[model samples]
Target chain A: MLVDPRATVADMLRARGISRRGFMKFCATTASLMALAPSMTPKVAEALQKARRTSVIWLPFQECTGCKESLTRAGGPTLENLIFDAISLDYSETLMAAAGHQAEEAMKNAIRENWGNYLLLVDGSLPVDVPEYSVIGGVSNLEMLKEVAAGAKAVVAIGTCSAFGGLPAARPNPTGARPISDVVKDKPLINVPGCPPMPIAITSVLVHYLTFGTLPELDHLNRPKSFFGQTIHDRCYRRPFYERGQFAESFDDEGAKAGWCLFKVGCKGPTTYNGCATYKWNLGASWPVESGHGCLGCSEPNFWDWQGFYNPLSTTQWGGYAQIGAAAAAGAAAGAVAALAARRKQRPVGQDVQEEGK
Target chain B: MPFEALDPRDAGRLEALTATASGAHGPDPEACESVRGRVDSGNVPLLLNEVRYALERLLDDGTTHAIDVRAIPLGPGEEDRLLDALGRGELRAEFDSLGRSEVQECAYPGVWCVTHYNEAGHVAGRFLEVTFTPALLASPPEDVRTGLERLAAELAP
Candidate 1:
């Protein structure tokens, strides 16, 4: 008659609203996403039962807050469920109701209490220009970063801005922004870069860290190889069109309606690395490349400066005027069309025949 | 043409001259292998290896005269300086960091190696200077010279 707290995965699934088949499928997806061998699903489920909750501290610097918004928009039941239910979010300015001095104290306490233990997550670039451009509670962003990073066992830079300084550190950068690696040198920092990185990517990195008690091996840019190893171009849905060299000449062209490649229109998918193609976004709804628009390549290092957003496919090298030439050609064509219309309006019905004869 | 006519007495002096300063004891500890042994092994190797490699590479070829590789090690405050240089992509150009652009063949026959140019376009004081030639560009035979240059450059700083 006594209820069992420790139920088999199937019994637990029945208690929660998931069917046995759906629970098995969930296990399979989790296994695949973790880059784990399918044989490890049973082990993972068992581990999940006894695993002590991990602590995570998310720090926001001079950023657009897009990373937080993206995390909130993660799939059903929400990644928040995993963060709160699976892991303890000790302090986050955006998520926590605690504010001002108390919030700051909470972050400090967490670091001191969990020294060489807890994970530190950061979003946004560290502003180096004048310091006044970005300040939190009278302390420079750089100062705060060094303090937190010094004792952290591991650090995760959650967005492009935090990873490679994103747009804030682009050429002729006014804010003098720098990546987390620039300021935080001692800790092992993993960079998850993108304007707003795919939700599954965020979750996978966390799960990997929690499961292994250490971060996965990172690439040259400190990005997890499992997600960022392949180019966006490699997995793009419209890659067939790119291979055939069938590109949409204009945004509103018939080829565009047919979902032709956006490479000719300056898609940086070929150079950029991310899991957008594999994971998709908005609960696997669709990514930018599938929406008939060229990829902006927000994930790659110094992408804002290195790859022009509207650079045509033929232009391979960085820093050129391919965009300017395209704009000029369009301007000239528009002018010619306007002139023809005026000439037609002035010409009489028979004048057309006379002009043809002439 | 007058090989037999040359003085045998000069050969002894030439050997002595070639051996000059090589084994001589000096106050500078770097030249003294015994003194170099006592210094912090970590710092010594880092500095000595980097500089020695750069110097050897720069002077390997006959074209360059004086070789100077500006060795800047980033410690604490130097991070900002290094980061600024890296961000601008000017650190390599200004300090003449070894790169793909520095590789080239010379007009000399059979000989082949990497080269660099000074501010005045002269090869003097340039890093990784080596003798390279056009005939060496051909395959099989070319691989031998190219392989040597690559090996030497890798051994360089």
Candidate 2:
């Protein structure tokens, strides 16, 4: 169903049989996802109540359609999907019913109608060297991205491919693949990088823009800090094991069975920054770590070339071994000092016994 | 090895771990105590202060507020501590729409805790609403109006 451009999000929701309570619930979830304090729910609700349906154009190039699946088929009709459905999604080759010339026309009309206001969401890397490597409606990926980005309010790189030149840009890159940032330099750009980023991360970014009228604060890598601020290791439930120097040696080992840290088994949680540990996947069901697999570090740049997935992080060149070394040394030093202090405390109690033995 | 290849006991352990990590179930008390020191309790005081401030705002301007408990970086057991400190009041309510929702008043008047669960029975969102009555409990004005029209139509014949 096409959402009316003039209709606010609240209007669309109401028409869909959602009550004010449901809307409030949605705002609450959005606020939580964005890491906004609970007190900000009212503000979020107020902003959404007046938020007009934004025009969104989704362009998929050399992607596997996993990102789209992540966003659309996140379990069921989630609140995120509700917001996505309410938006005026004018052009999506995979989702839109119109095809061939009719599909191209719909995109042209959307761009013309919402010039300099529409949000451009691009997934997958672009083949700059060989434009023919990927094309849609007779337009090469590179040419299409540059053309659409010119009129966009902001360009959101939706997956690892579009954000950081994913698997296609791996070593011996064949397509001369480059991320959206390499091509769309002039537009305000944000990256939601992941091998199919978390659905909440994608929608939360959109909600922040709709509620605050600006993109959420981004890290140096141009990723939303709210979702990518902390590494997966920092929040992983198995962190206690990592701290205690316990690790799963193999996929079927006793450590793995006991839910120990996957660091030794080539887990990339320590260096990979994403919300997977905290938010989980499949609607907070379980993440890679929880499911007995190491993080593939898909969200970070050049993850595919980071040695091997099953190799321990310390063995990988991109693992930030220097930081790990310093942290390990500090932990050892602290442990030594604590042990010394405990010995001193015991010395007082055993002083007479020691003297008698002498 | 794939997840299906794991021993059933191992699979159960992973499932339990996932449930515990996702806050679907509380951590075992013995395990909780062992890791208690590792977790930070600072958010509890800050949250209590926010609750106090919200309560004052409710009294002063008659404006209700809600604090999303899930948004805060709460340490283990901190949530339970905060709830215990608030103490349960007399009123309690449960409703179902998209999923189950529970709203219960706190010891302090105008302070309520609201928890929403998804259809899968997983906690989707949690909040502390500082209002005389949560908006969820009341019939929406539109719904009330529609009900009135339906009743009138039935009487007209």
Candidate 3:
């Protein structure tokens, strides 16, 4: 169904049977996710309610379509997707039924009409060296990007490919893949990268842009600091296990079975930063580690080339050994038992002090 | 008897060298006692906003929150500012768990300032909390009930 570009977001939400309470609830959640004080919820809701429909032109280049799944999974009916859907998506070749000349014309029309105001969303990497490697309509990925980006208010690099040369730019990269930042350096660029970014994470960026009329505060990687400021290890549920020097040696060992830390199995949670711990995936469903798989460090730069997915990450730089040295030598099977035993034996700290307070 | 206006040329220098340092009138500037006490704390505004939000959440949804003050960089006087802004409520407690802990309810209802000190008595951890009761003092009611039931059974036998 075609939505009018002129309608305020509030009008659209009302049309969809969404109540103010629901919208406000989502805003509160978003504000919390953004680490904003609760007072900001009203502002978030007001911005979303009254904001004009923004024109978004999504350009997919050398890539797989995994990102779409994250969008569809979490973004289907929630306010996050509703806000995203409320935006006037003038062109997305993969999503739009229009093909051939019709598709190209839609792209041109959107650019011409909303010049300097529309947002350009790019997923996948651009085949810079070999234009012929990937093309939409006889125009190379780089050529098309340069043309469309020229008229954009901001550019959002939607996946690892567009931020850091993702899988397509992996070893012996055949397509001469390059990230969006490498190509479009002038515009206000935001990198919302992951294997396929969490849908809420992606939508929050759009909401932030609409609310403030500018990109959200970004980290060193130009990704939103609210989401990417801390590594997965920092927020991981298994972090306490890691601190105590307990680790799963293999995929199905006792440590693994008991939900010990995955560091020994090459879990990239420590170095990788993403909202997998906080937001999880698949409609607040479990992420990999919860289900017994280690983190692949999918959100990081050049993660594909980081080599062994199952190999343990070197912790010499982080002083992992020195921190947990006394217990580091013990294997997970022995460590878990020993730690539990030690915890029981350790003197109860400040019991007498607590009695006084009581 | 009468006030005569000073000549313009003399007016500029009439105050004299000593007068300039001490001011033309009133007490000498240097004689005024030096200021003391914290004027403002930088972190107060941020932490106050956090407290406000936490209060709203607690009232609206019964959500509990913990604010680690140490995790946030405190300005020179911000901690004092936060303390002043928070004021003080009914609850106050101190503990030596692991090291030492001081928990106090702030001026705002349900808001608390919890500071943990290491063995050296220096603050090792500090937090602002918003909740019906401090987390450290809370124990599970269900667990307590179960233990009580078991104890009653033991006494009966």
Candidate 4:
């Protein structure tokens, strides 16, 4: 195949000092991760070699910029090499060199020139309730999102914000936050959710698209099945602790120091899903759970509103415990009956005992 | 004779194994440390331990009738394959006859799964795990789930 002179996975990898062997290994890893056959690696490798440069416009909305922070700290190569080196990231309001009118002009030009081919990566929610809550260049985020998304080839909703309205859209959503799916129905949308999804997850999606020229298969939630398919509980390292009923009751407790399960300490790991454990944060050094913190389940929809951060799963099923209380009451009744029988036996034949009781 | 006389050292090993099983004594510190080291090294045995530990916690026993496999980054047509296996009674029978479930809880979020099996050694529970990274999807499709299932089987105490 006549590999593209530019934008090939090899060229990108080489620029990062990754050897040809390492590049193939990466492709093989990607292919395997996608659940593709071993034979598919060559195809993926070829596709990536021939793939065209994909222009991406990353927009930060009303957010703490945590998503960007996580992306910057993503595992693998330097942050610049991962994003700027691979994809033609035309404009990132956070990182772009241009500023003021020049920045805005560059964005406008990218959208106009790229037209239906560019990818619009949105990292926050759109506040419809209050236009004044989040504004960029005198226009609401919703307005700019709709404008750019209209001509986009595809939309990547980065983080829980853009994916599921995130924390902003939690109960009593003050800004009436809405997900990207709600507004942009014209194109395919890939929801890469998390408080800020694993940075490698974000970059891998770009790699998959570059290699396959299409987004990876997604689950019902529009999340890439490869990443958001399973629950955090399923792959938790503390699972053994959970199994043995060894749990950390409180932060900094004995069990916590022993690395016991946090299920009793309001760990949402069971129901939540993400690759925090296997692929630790900050270049695979360590994640929150490894550091003795419980999972907050920031990826799931309305997590902040529904799943109580301080509430443990064992205590959450309040009704189940009610049954236990009932059982205890029955046991008490049985105990009372047994005591009465014992007293009657101790008394002179049944007659005198009843009379004395009366 | 079918039975061979045991050497004194062999007898000692048997006694040690028995004591460990009785919970009067646990695996020696060196042995425990070796296992921990293996796990940290990402050895295949780590996967087995994780799967088994999860099963023991969830099912109270590693007995089941059927097992269903869900690969990381579930493939596009993989569901159909599973459904077919389930419908034809192959999967259901495995659960009906002998199955067990296993779960893997990684530190990362969204990398969990469950499996099922039966009392007669069939897998009845689901195999669940989270995958926050794309690296998990880097396994060969056919082998991934099967390998997981095998590891889960080994995880049975």
Candidate 5:
């Protein structure tokens, strides 16, 4: 295929003077992020090394360019982003120097060149009712999406706006915005939804595809299960506080100042799913909850339609009776399974066998 | 005879293997390190199945869960072997809480190991806690409040 000139992530890392240990560490970290066993580290490293350059087209639509900005300006570039950037990204409306007709022409050319083999990354949501709500190079956002998605190997809805009809699709969606899934149904789509999403999650999805040549396992929402497998509340450092019923009543109260759980002060961590609790923003400096603010659940669908961000989470919004019972059951099940497995492992000898004809 | 006479050196190795099972005397340190150097456990299939099951549970609710290893007695060097199989992840935290604690995350998310030391600095308790959140950071809020209150009282008349 006449894809853009590309280099394997290994080659890029080597060229950048990353040693074998450094590269292995990066692979190990990636494996962990994807929740793969340590045994899979070498496999991940090898797969990444031999991965072919994938062509990606990042399409921005009727939303703020925050997704693009967050990923491109990820606090500090790591090996993950290095591999992501290493891909043959022939067209990115935000990143490309070409403008107007030239940019559109370049994308069409790239699409023609890589046809049916390139990745389609859409960052913004499309407005269906008002075609003029968003236009790129004279083509409406919805039309542009259909055209590009037709030839894509897989369509990745990059942010909440594109994946779940975010801010643009909030209550009374004026422009009548719709998510990419609502538009492109045939193509395999992966949602990396967040307000701006986690840079690592975005990179993980791309690397996962590059290494395995298939989309990473996704959740019901079509978000990568590795990143969305755990709710922020389940893993937050302040969860013990929540278990102990210690909640920050106000933004500046002692609980807040003491970094207690933000469940009371509009914290949606309990219900929101992402790796923010583990992989914080700004290179592990802090996440919203760590900063003493409640999670806004920006990555979830129709997040803007949810209760206000700063208001305390309603009992229904939090893990109420049913969810709590389920969580407890899961915990109990885990304990029982572990105990049974342990007992079986410990007492493996068959010493009580009786002989028939002694 | 089916059994061949063992060499004295071979006998030592056999004894070491048996000792490994008994846990009365640990495996040879050099032998343990040598096994660590091996890329994969000869018993990959079993470990793979076990770890996979644990991983499935982890992905179910996105809630952090722990599989306490205290009850699961391990043979000498088995802990290291398991951790090796699990793979050390990005986060490695060291702190002095009850004597000292070194907590390490496994390559797979939601798996962690914490080794606590006594006041004399000997290894006191070792736990392989599997959870979405690292166990070291899970201090109760009441403890924090009491500690804060005590500190305040200490400073007051």
Candidate 6:
């Protein structure tokens, strides 16, 4: 698992004994994950063939290690993990072998060596009120973020904690937690917000950066539009049940057995935007709704403080039933047109099916 | 005293509820079948038209095209209908690399259905490729070079 600093992604894959065909498969999957049309597969393959390993600096602060666990503890060695492994991860408190001053030196050296070129990834929130509340190696979270982000080409807020000041900023905030965006204003920052964002979402962002040398288009929230453009309700398999007004009343109701919508039982999918319904969790095995539970809306800002998770969305002060219905209809229509327009916009100019010289 | 406190009818209902809850991981097969029979998103016709356009492009020029089947939201059983309409051709090729891959030509010339599976045997990607022949079917140049070197060494006397 020794990766050469200068090796291209293709070179790294080949060194790992991956054949060209395997590389093609990887590109194909990457394109799909990035929501790029299948025609872009060759372009992905070509770009990856020349993509040099990027130096990534992962900083963790006031938060649980769930995001790291989600990225690394996916059921098995997925292509996403392989691509992540290809990156030159110079610093990570949990993942790196270096410790204490040695780890600090690695971080500083990585910044000095690849300054203005390296990508910065932050996973927890910053306790701005009392910086000492979340200090690492004697450096306050706020100070460390400001210092590291200055040298980064772009900063990626890896989870809801870093992106939207997740649980730490929920309610009655003790130390006044804040998202990375609040602190870092100069650099381009993209949020991949989730309780622990989808593994593919994280990898897809990395690959998008690698392939095009630019971050993917972002929504108003600065989350990748490709992965978070649509609400979970838009793509839920039980959407038909919701449309038909068939919902499970209780956990073991007949409707529950029949796989009806959990909307009445506090599913926040209608408002929560993430790729959980589409890309799914556990390598497309199942998500919360599929397991007969309501969506906790973990990806949204202040979700932890959202009215009781067991109370139906309609019961909350967010909206009434009629408003929800109207919104759903309007959102669906607009989403369709927007999706089609975006697809057309994304297509590479001039070659339809295959690029020239293919 | 505990047995007397619990009603026999309540115990039976609880057992039934437990069975129902445990099976809630996925949609019931019967309901799925019923839904599949009723739902038609009308994507097949549009996809077929797309395939026709791709074929015309391939015929007019040497350009090839690929449509990701997984990307499109086809309604229940719509994929089957589309695949059935395409109809399988004589040639079928399978490649084992990162996992399993099957490339097969459809009834229409230059129309192909390509499927790639991961090591876990789950379908990772599915594409409808419009080309004279899939590029994957060809031996990569690097592999050919490696083969040549190995063969030459084997033949050396």
Best by lDDT: 6
Error of 2 at B41 (Å): 13
Task: Compose the digit string of candidate 6's lDDT tens values, residues A115-170.
Answer: 99999999999898989998898889898998999999999999999998888886
Which digits, one per residue and each the tens of the lDDT, describe model 2 over residues A149-200? 9999999999999998888877667998888988888889999999999988
Candidate ordering by DockQ (highest first): 6, 2, 4, 5, 3, 1
Residue A243 local lDDT, model 6:
54
lDDT of each: 0.56, 0.76, 0.68, 0.59, 0.66, 0.78
Best by TM-score: 6
Q: Write the per-residue lDDT of candidate 5 for residues A1-358, one digit (tens) a residue.
A: 2333566777776565554544555665567556565457669988988877888898889778888778877644344455665688879888889888888888989899999999999998889899897988788988888899899999999999888778887756799887888889899989998999988788878888888898999877788987887677655656545544555566545565455666666776756778886667754434666544578888776667666776655554334534433543564353333234322322111111112112
User: lDDT for model 1, on a 0 to 1 scale?
Assistant: 0.56
* Model 1 per-residue lDDT at A327: 33
Error of 3 at A112 (Å): 0.9
Best by DockQ: 6
Question: What are the TM-scores, per candidate, against the unseen true structure?
Answer: 0.57, 0.76, 0.64, 0.60, 0.62, 0.79
Better of 2 and 3 by TM-score: 2
Better of 1 and 5 by lDDT: 5
- lDDT for A205 (candidate 3): 83
Model 1 lDDT tens row, A104-182 = 9998888888888788899999888767788788888888888888777889999889987877876566888878888
Please state the error at residue A348 of candidate 4 in Å.
69
Model 2: C-alpha RMSD to truth? 11.5
For model 4, how does the per-residue alpha-carbon lDDT over A135-209 read when each residue is reduced to its tens digit? 878888988988999889899999988887888876567998878888889899998889888876787688778
Write down the RMSD of all candidates, one decimal each: 30.5, 11.5, 28.1, 20.7, 24.2, 9.4
Of candidates 4 and 3, the better by lDDT: 3
* Runs of candidate 6 exceeding 4 Å displacement: A315-319, A322-358, B1-65, B72-91, B104-113, B119-122, B130-132, B149-157
C-alpha lDDT of residue A331 in model 5: 46
TM-score of chain B of 4: 0.25
Q: A145 in model 2: Cα distance from truth in Å?
A: 0.9
